[model samples]
Structure formats: structure tokens, C-alpha cells
Target: MARKRGLGRDDVVTAGLAVLDHAGIDAVSLAAVAERLDVRPPSLYAHVDGLAGLKRDLAHTTTVEFGEVLRDSVLGRSGPDAVRSFADAYRRWATGFPGRYEMTLLPIAADDDERRAGARLALGAVQAVIRGFGIDETSAIQAGRSLRSALDGFSRLENADNMGRGDHDADFAFLIDLLIDGISQAGTQPPGPA
Candidate 1:
């Protein structure tokens, strides 16, 4: 019979996410998680290589969770309806889980499993949106980048409490509508000047 691992990697990752959700990313150290789990800091090495590894895993986990939210929100929808749903989900995820949402801004690296996982999750969300418009892969990627930029910008601003006074919800809605119009135009635009 195989010996059971005391603190599985997934458990550590999950705990790390909890730490992130409750506190900010900076508070999620192996020692911190160890304290939360009532284990020695050294014991965490068996489950996670180090703090960096934990951060990577947390990023991967956050992305996967975000992907599920997007999938559920955008499925069976199309056109502006899908776009609006996706945008709302994205904003909700960001506002609801600020620390996890901040992980999306981390720089991706080659040869990193977490990076691949994060990419997969992000791409899955984009594909969900792309499917709504029946866009090709190239166009989908472009549109995805645009949508991500817009959402990220708005969320970051809001999280920083820089949205400024006067009906932020109205402003957010207008931005979403603008993005939908932009995406629609891009979908129908002809290639290059004649």
C-alpha cells in the first residue's frame, strides 16, 4: 500500500488560497500557512518546494477558479449578451477576491507549470467569450486581449479606490457597452485599406 502524504500539495495550495482570500498576497508565506495548518514551517517543504512554489500554485488555483466562473457565466449566451455576462463575471471575480484577482497581473514564465495552468484558465475564459461571436482563433486572441485589458484596467482602478465620485456603476456599464460595440465593429471590419 502507498504511504499517505501528510499535507498534500493540493491542500497546501488550497490553504494558500484561503490565506490570500482572507489576507492579501503578501501575507501568504509558507510559515503563515504552517501556522494556519498547525504544522511546522519545515514540514511545508514536503508539500511545497518553497514560498515561490506556493505562490505559483496559488496563482494556478486562482486562475482555474476564475475560469469556472467565466464558463458558467458565458455558456449558452451569444453576442453582446455573452460579452456582458463575461464582463460582469470578471468584475465580480475581481471585486469578490481581490488577492486572487491580483494574481492575474503576475508575469508568466516559461517552464512554469503554474504559468501554463494560469494560461489555460485565462484562455478558457477567452474562448468562452470568442465562441459567442463565432470568431476565429486569431481574432479571438485579439479580442480576448482587448477585453482583458479593459476589464483589468477597470478592476485595478476600482480596487485601488480610484474610481472617483459620481455614479461609478453607470460609468462601468457605459464602459462595458463601449467594449461590446468595439468588439462588434472589429468582428465586421474588412481587412486593410483598399
Candidate 2:
């Protein structure tokens, strides 16, 4: 097949993301991407190394995309109100883009600068919200993990179609309430052993 006249790496990544969002991660093969781009699989090699490389790139971009979702979700917001916005945004994005959201869970290697930065960008956004409750820097990491654990667990359950599906909004509101209450209490407590 003739190489597309103006194909580029970003085009490939965008095509991969489309395939992922439409099908799933497993469907983002080089052939699939190339077919979508109207190019041959080998044509992707000029832009991406291969399937593995393409997936790595996809993960990086997806992570950054999610971070942007988070940052935008809480812009000009603060405190528990920010937490509610953060959770709502998180759930909406995670459930809305199951395939891409899964990419955010991929492990970022030490040398994966782009991927690591993307993760930091995403997590740091949430951490910033966690810190809004007036928790100390040292304690915020633990608190952030706890809050993320709750959000991740709930989103995963909802994605799996296994949740009771009864009032996810109210359920998320209740989760945020528990989180806000706990964070408020934690901020007031003296440092204690984990």
C-alpha cells in the first residue's frame, strides 16, 4: 500500500487511541493502527518502533490525557469541594474511556521520563487536592494513597458492570463524604504511627 502522504507519530498515536477507545488495549495492534490510518503496518515503524513501542507511547499519552482531565476538573476549586470534583471527573473519565483509563495503571519505568512525568502530573493533581485539607506534606502521601485507593476501587467496580449500579452519583457523594470526613479528622490528629 502507498504510504500516507502526511502520516506522523502523533497521527499514529491518535489512531491507536481511537482503536483502544473503540475496542480495547488488545486491539491496538500495529496493523490495526495502520489500517485505520490507511497505511501498511510497516509504515508505522517510521513513526513508532513496533507494537510494544506503540503501546508504551499510548500509555504515556493516555496518562497525560488523564492528568489533563484531572487538572481541568479541579481548576479554581479547593478543599472538599475540589475532592468531589476530582472524584466525579475521575469516575467519569475512567468509566467513559475504559481502554485509555487502563493505560494509566501501567507501571512507569525509571528511565521512562515521559511516562513518569505523566504519572507525576496526574497523581500530583490529586495530591494537590489532598493537600488542600491542610494535611502535612509527609502525611499527604499516605492520605493520597488512601483516597486514590477508594476512587480506583470504586471506578474499577463500576467499570466491570458488577456494581449494584444503584445511584453511583449518590454513592460517589457518600464516598467523597467519607473521604472528606476522614481527611478532616486526619488533619486534626497528632502524628501517629501508621
Candidate 3:
């Protein structure tokens, strides 16, 4: 029994990630994780509050990991170069870790520490690109939203196999370039449109 009960919370999360990767989000459950760990369903309660809690924790973990990829890819880069790098990294991370990447999109409430750390990681990536334009904090935040939306939209579309006709990579590159140019022009534009 001691050997059978050796599983821990991290073990449950690890098993959950495996289930997510092998199957899909819908397939991950407390029972599934327990089965993977060869433990009783009740055993999970000691680790995760419930399925929602487990999923939230997984999402948070995945987001942090994704943020690290963005950080590493965009660091020390600037301007359009940084933008392209960040965009490419985002796509790559999502493609490479589809299960984990999907988790990042799930809406979940995070504690202060999780929220702050995740925000810093996410903002740090955005700031890397925005800093290139010498944008202010407010503008940086706005640009970050735009950047995230574009990347998220593109990744979601691609994941769904929704690209219609053109070459996906070429189209993605074009969009990234367009976004970089748009941000640059926005920086130079007057407060209001003419």
C-alpha cells in the first residue's frame, strides 16, 4: 500500500499533463489522473481541490512555461526584429506544446503570487518588443494586448486547421510584419487620426 500511495501532487499534475498530451483537454480528469498514478480517485483530493483546481494549476504552469519561451526568444532584441522573434516564438511554443498551450487560453483565477509572476513573465516578453519602439507604459500595455491577440488568433486558427488557401508560414510572416509596421506607425501618428 505504501508503494501504491507514493504518488504526490506533482505526480498528479505530471500525469494530468500526459493525459492532456495524449488525449485532449476534455479527457483530463481527476479519475484519469488517479488511474494514471494507479491511485484511488480520493487520493487526488489531497493534491488538487477538484478538476477545476487541477486544470487551473496546469494552465498557470503552462502559461509560465510559455512566457519563459517568449522571454528567451525576445530578449536583447528590439523593434521589428523583436516583434518577429516574439511572434515566431509564440507560434513555435504553441505548436510544440499544443496541450500546454491550450491551457494558457483557459480563464482561471490565480492567487496573488501566481498572478504577479505570470503577469511579469508575460509583460516582460511584451516589454521586450515594445521597448524597441521607446513606447510609454500605457502604449506598451496596449501594444502587448494587440500583439497577444494577434498571436493568439493566429495560433488558434492554425490549430483548428482553418487556414484557407495560402501558405501558412508565409501568411503568418506577412501578418507579423504588418503588425510591426502598424505599431511603428502608431508610435509616430498624431494623437488622433487626421
Candidate 4:
């Protein structure tokens, strides 16, 4: 196999993301990425450790991006409006990049500082949404977890075409509205980090 010029770690990762997005995780391999980059499969090792290392990098990159997207979606908004925007953005990102979104479910080892940092950003965004409901520190963590659970379940169901015969958009809207109403009834305290 001939060496491909201008190949780099980012190039390999970009190719991996493209292939993963286009053909799903099962199609993402060193050979596929190298083929996308017009390089030999062995050439990828010069940039990434191997397939596992490449996947780790992909996970880290996508997690950070996911956090940023969620955080940005609610910027300049507050309360129920913020919750709506954040929830909608969550679904959009998940559906848009289903393969990368799946990476969020995998373990990010405690010692992996970069991945941990990314996870923190994501957690912070979720916590902020729950806090927007005026949930205090005492309830933010639980509320955040609950919110994530709801979103994850619906997203997975929708992606798999298992959301029954109902209108998904209406069901999602109702779910968000239910959450807003419940949180609103819980008492409106000032928003703060848990």
C-alpha cells in the first residue's frame, strides 16, 4: 500500500466521523477511515494507536461537541423556554449524529482527564436545565438525571422507530411540557449549580 501524503490524526478522526455518521458504528474501522482518507489501513497507526484509540478520540470529540450544542441551545433563554430549547436541541443532535451520540453511553474512565472533562461539560448543561426549573442544589442532580433518562429513552425509541404509532413531535412536546409543569409545581427557587 502506498503512503498517503498529508495524513494526520485529525484527518483520520474526521474520516472516522464521516464514515460512522454515514454508515453507522459497525462500518467504522481503520480500513474504512484509511480508505476515506485515501491511505493504507496501516497508515492510520502513525496518527492513532489503532482502531480502539481512534474510537476513544472520536468519543471524546463527539462528547465535547454534544455538550457545547446543548449548552448553546439554551443560551439567552431561561425557565421553561430554556428547557424547551435544550430538549429540542438534544433530540436534534442525537438524531443528527446517532453514532457519535451513542458514545456518550460508554464509560469514560475516571483517569481519562479529557473524557472526564467532556462529561463534566455535558453534566453541567443538563444540571443547568434542571436548575432552570428553579430546582435548588438539593434536587438538581436528581432532576438532571431524570431529564436525561427521559430524553435518552425517547431518543432511542424514535431512532429505532419504536415510538408506537403516535406523532413523535407531539409526544415529545407533551413530555417536555409535563416536565416543565412538574418542576414548576415543585416550587420556584432561584437557579444555581447543584
- Per-candidate count of clashing residue pairs (backbone under 3 Å): 0, 0, 0, 0
Model 2 Cα displacement at 48 (Å)?
0.2
Q: Residue-wise lDDT of candidate 3 within 33-101, one digit each (tens)?
A: 888887778778888989987897787777788878889888778899899989999998887667888
lDDT of each: 0.80, 0.87, 0.81, 0.83
Better of 1 and 4 by lDDT: 4
Per-prediction TM-score to the true structure, in the order listed: 0.85, 0.94, 0.88, 0.91
Which predicted model would earn the best TM-score? Answer: 2
- TM-score of the candidate numbered 2? 0.94
Which 10 consecutive residues of model 1 have the lowest summed lDDT? 185-194
How much does candidate 4 score in TM-score? 0.91
Give lDDT tens digits, candidate 2, residues 129-190.
88788887656777788888999999999888878848888888898899988888888888
Candidate 2 lDDT for residue 31: 90
Residue-by-residue lDDT tens digits, candidate 4, 80-141: 89889989999999988888888777788777789888888778777777776665666666
Question: Which has the better TM-score: candidate 1, or candidate 3?
Answer: 3
lDDT of 1 at 95: 86
- Residue 137 local lDDT, model 3: 61
lDDT of 1 by residue, 1-194 (tens): 23335768887888788899889888999888887777778788888879988887787777778877887887888888888888999998898899998885677667777567756766776777766776555666777788989998998899888988988778989998988877776667653222
Residue 176 lDDT, candidate 3, scale 0-100: 94
- Top candidate (lDDT): 2
